[model samples]
Target: MTVATRLQSMQPTDIGVPGPTPGDMARAFRSVRRDPLTFLEQVTAHYGDRVSFPVPGAPALLVNDPDEVRHVLQVSARNWNKKTVQYGALARVTGQGLLASAEPSWIEHRRTAAPAFHHQRLEAVSDEVRAAADTALAAGLAGLVPGTGRVVDVAALTHRVGLDAVGRALFSADLTGHAQQLLDATSDAAELVVRLGRSVMPTARWAPSPTNVRLRLTRRRLDAITAQLVAERRSHGRAGSGAAYGDDLLGLLLDSGLTDVEVRDELVTMVIAGHETVAAALTWTLMLLAEHPDAQERARAELAGLPAPVSMLDHRDRLPWTRAVIDEALRLYPPAWAISRRSIGPDSLGGTDVPEGTLAIISPWVVHRRADLWPDPLAFRPERFLDPGAGRSGYLPFGLGPRLCIGREFAIGEMAVVLDRLLTTHRVAVPDGWRRPRPQAQVAVHPEGGMPLLLTRLRAERRD
Candidate 1:
């Protein structure tokens, strides 16, 4: 028999976990392909927290129980590695960078990259964010009457600001000149990654199919940008630090004695992950605010009477309500919706026997929406976060455990700065008869068809 035929016959029936039959899955294949989120939610809800799947060869389990998720991501993290199909696709683009790297080496990589994101260093990120935000506002939304709202694509605006901020803060380089080129390449790369994830039969990266060819070109363009960045940094000669490179992430990577190819991989990884994730967060936050004007106004009020031109760190604790709104947005629409891992060894999770090589998928999208974990899970209530104890468990927006996102603070601060600044000068509201955008789960949960919102410039007196 063929490989597919042999594997299909070897489906696990005694895993001590419940899941849809292969026939049921076959019937829902189209729906699953079109909208994985809905399918996942429905399956989890139907099968309870820990559900197995009818995949051949390797067993697949969706771990939705909070404790099971914690066990996989935190308690038994070492037993799980990023060797699954989800991260495998990411590794194709990012190579073995921190985001997609497995353990042992990833430990060293994290140590090497830590200093660059030190508390003091990241404080400077607010300045970069403010500068980028100001530039984006001037270029994208310059002419606007207070009441006569203009239809604006805030998603694109967030992408610009996100790329600019990451470039400045981490690389100590301005990326405004290469923003469109880089964004287009990264966007294409993300689309390709999603397509790979959706495919029933995996395509080899070496195969010269149309998708593979496009991905090759996209990677080439990204490599070209990476080369430009490295060359410019070399020419500038450390920018007054007298070190071979400067005291930024690039410098740290260089000092770590990594090879040129290794450095390129990390740079590309940062360029994609650092910007795209935060941009999605920022864009989704804007969409949430636009849909709920009361919540938006409350958040804007918290921004008022703050120290003039406060830095990101300064605004961290001061804007509790605003921060609450952001927290809620992240819960509702986490950028990295699914975090997947492969079982490196035999382990029991949620009282289910998960064999070695099993795929354990933890979806923050589903976890965040669990009514048992979160009361009134569907409603957009920022007030829920006002309690200090809230979101201590079952919340993994930036993920949980040692593999938690290194740039969590950076992204959070950047979002706060952009949201604060935008709220100070303009009121964002959904246009009349505006339909909420269904999230398109790609590299991140992007709003379908883009987020077009109405922007009304606030009068100076209203700011007081």
Candidate 2:
């Protein structure tokens, strides 16, 4: 049957909105647990833009209408706070850092952290990103013969580049020594967060279940890393005074008068959230490029026109197509796939009244795929972004408004450097009938298995 026919067949929800009945939801429980993204897509197609979810005490609504999403996330943001199960689960690892904080204190935290991402600092970060990407690419491609290509797990390499970039640019430290431990700990924490978020009846944090025990161990590992970062800085007598400390984000936080505990929270937040998201974005970009060699070649052509000894920061104005490719990739696979907010006060979204304490779930994965907003939304066409007049009303890869990610510019720049270098140095391709990896959501939406692609190294002259 058609969407209109399906809508007509289903009765309106208790709040007079379109959605599945309790029985329908109960029947789809397995699908929801297996892949919430696909389950949400199926429901939104049937029910319409604003779908209400049945919950006993909490009134839950999935706001997919761009305008309504704006109302909840941007226009009337203060009315919707991040006190939902999503953020609550994340806070187990990040504490009250900016990523999960809902209190007014986050305002000060944002202000204090803003300078670390200023234009000048980002220019400096560009150098570090280029270095990190080059180092990672060199090591990862060391074994490949000159004329042949090998299957490489691009996801792992990008994660290394992202972590090293975050360490050097943000903290003025090296994280390679702790790379394996850090990656494992963050992975465990992300899986645990997803488990808690999806649990119908979440176990208390204090419980000694296997999940909780794993959670505690993961937190402790992360805390120890944070402590090491701080201790290393203090060893150089940079912990006490702003002038004595270096000018990276770590020093800035130390000088901002935050307690040692607050510093640890912010440090861990950046170390975990910052690198993982960038890595996911780059990994998806590479996969898309591999699938669309024409787009990859076009991006390489754009990069080829740049002057010799190119500086990504200084030559950014000449790389529109390169930037557009990254934009389209983000549109397809936004790292922060789902965003949740709880209403502190009653609000109306898309003409539907959202009662106080209602939960608003906004999935970029859903919104970015809306056919009404994007022309042929499922197709991978980076040219769509080339149109200067293209509207962003339905696009939100890095979120919207005040709580927008402060490191937006940094992340984009990091991806650009890696893409430019990789496209210039090697050819990215997949085997015949190669299927895209299934998207599995943990902390970020990542390919179920790592993204493996063939990388054929280009000659030295070709890179120039």
Candidate 3:
């Protein structure tokens, strides 16, 4: 039988499901505001793995099973579309960018943009990534007070580092001048999206209000900046060489015959997706390392053996422990916590019937931490990734299939370079009584209060 037909054949009772009551819906909404991860866990706890929640005028299914998530995101991708609520906010900032656009358009855009992230292309930019990381680390360490030894906010430092890397690599420009402004804009846009997401009902695009106005303004500001950069590149020809800018991401996008609006959307998507996730992953990695000095020392030892002027691309495969640390961090705190999709046709996932127009919610936050899948789900253990026999399905920091992040390699390379440089030069330690910050699930899972740490330059002997 066809997937849709099979879905129709199953009765609601047979699916072991019931409509979310009014009280349940109210509580669910409240939990979404206060703590979305907890809210999802509560739903799963109360209603089992394949539960349907009342989404006002729409049908929504929260799928926690790894197999089901894989099927929705990969196998039967054609049967799904990005929920308007999620993409509506993204569309405001991105304007039909690959991330926000659905189906054929998104596919075309991805195809056009894929070459820029090809292995050969990214290898050429590895030096830029390492240089940006070095610049960020040097600045961070220089800011350290002399005697008192003030604590550094590692999360903040890493965000700056990640932004610097993306700026230098993607546009071949320094973002230091506009970093704070861009960050503010991105953060504000994320908040506005979350607020707008909760309030927006599906298929109510025509209904207009203040939120719409703010979204438009935010989009305009972001686009205006991106447009200026593109215009500058067009006028300048190429950086120094003036030879038409070979294979950088910007050049590739320009050569793809995309309109200015389309280019801006992709740029915005890359900046946000590429930088934010790397920064968060780096922050969490350092935080975890700080709590485990042995792991920190081992990672440092790995870095010590690296040749001078190390490029993450060259050393990523060589440094097994370093890669494992990043994996563990992602497992604990995936920046892209929840991925949502709207079903275009009826389907049965994990044996539950989902009708057309249903919202399928796949949360890495829940799946990675499920006690059944991960032993001591809350513990910080990088070694789990090193186990050759370990199941990989439950771990998806960059996602899977055709829609997987194109910048995955770039992110890994950048992180490895930064960590190698930082750990080799300084000892990062958390201040006593410094509580780990709760993750604010906005656009990415970033520490709300910033990750604070004490950085002490390693003595020559200590380095050995």
What RMSD, rounded to one decimal, does every model reach? 2.4, 4.4, 5.5
Where does candidate 3 stray beyond 4 Å? 1-15, 18-20, 56-58, 143-148, 200-210, 237-245, 314-316, 459-464
TM-score of candidate 2 on Cα atoms, chains taken together: 0.94
As a TM-score, model 1 comes out at: 0.95
Tens digits of per-residue lDDT, candidate 1, 4-43, equal 3533455664687888877677678778878999999999
lDDT of each: 0.84, 0.84, 0.77
lDDT value, candidate 3, whole model: 0.77
TM-score of each: 0.95, 0.94, 0.90
| The best candidate in terms of TM-score | 1
Candidate 2 — worst ten consecutive residues by lDDT sum?
Answer: 3-12
Clash pairs (backbone) in predicted model 2: none
Candidate 2 deviant stretches above 4 angstroms = 1-13, 238-244, 308-316, 461-464
Local accuracy of candidate 2 as per-residue lDDT tens digits, 1-464: 54233423543337787777766766777689889999989989999888888776557899898888899889999998999999999888889999988888998999998989888888866777777787788889886655678789999999998888898889987788888888888888889989988876678889999999999999999999989998888788844444646678898888788898899889888887888899999999999999999999998878776765234454357678888888889999999999999999888887777678989999999999988878899888898888765648988888998899888888888888788778887889996668889999888899989998989987544333
Model 3: lowest-lDDT 10 consecutive positions: 6-15
Candidate 3 lDDT over 1-464, as tens digits, reads 54234333333322356545545565455567768877777778777777776444356778888889889888888888885577766776666777777747888888877877777767777778777777777677675433335588988889889888888888788888878877777777877767766552432445577766776777777877788889987886656654544477787788777888788889998888778889989999999998899999998988788765456565457888888888888889998888888888889887667678878878888888888888998999889878855658787787777778778888888888888778876888889897889888877788888899888776422221
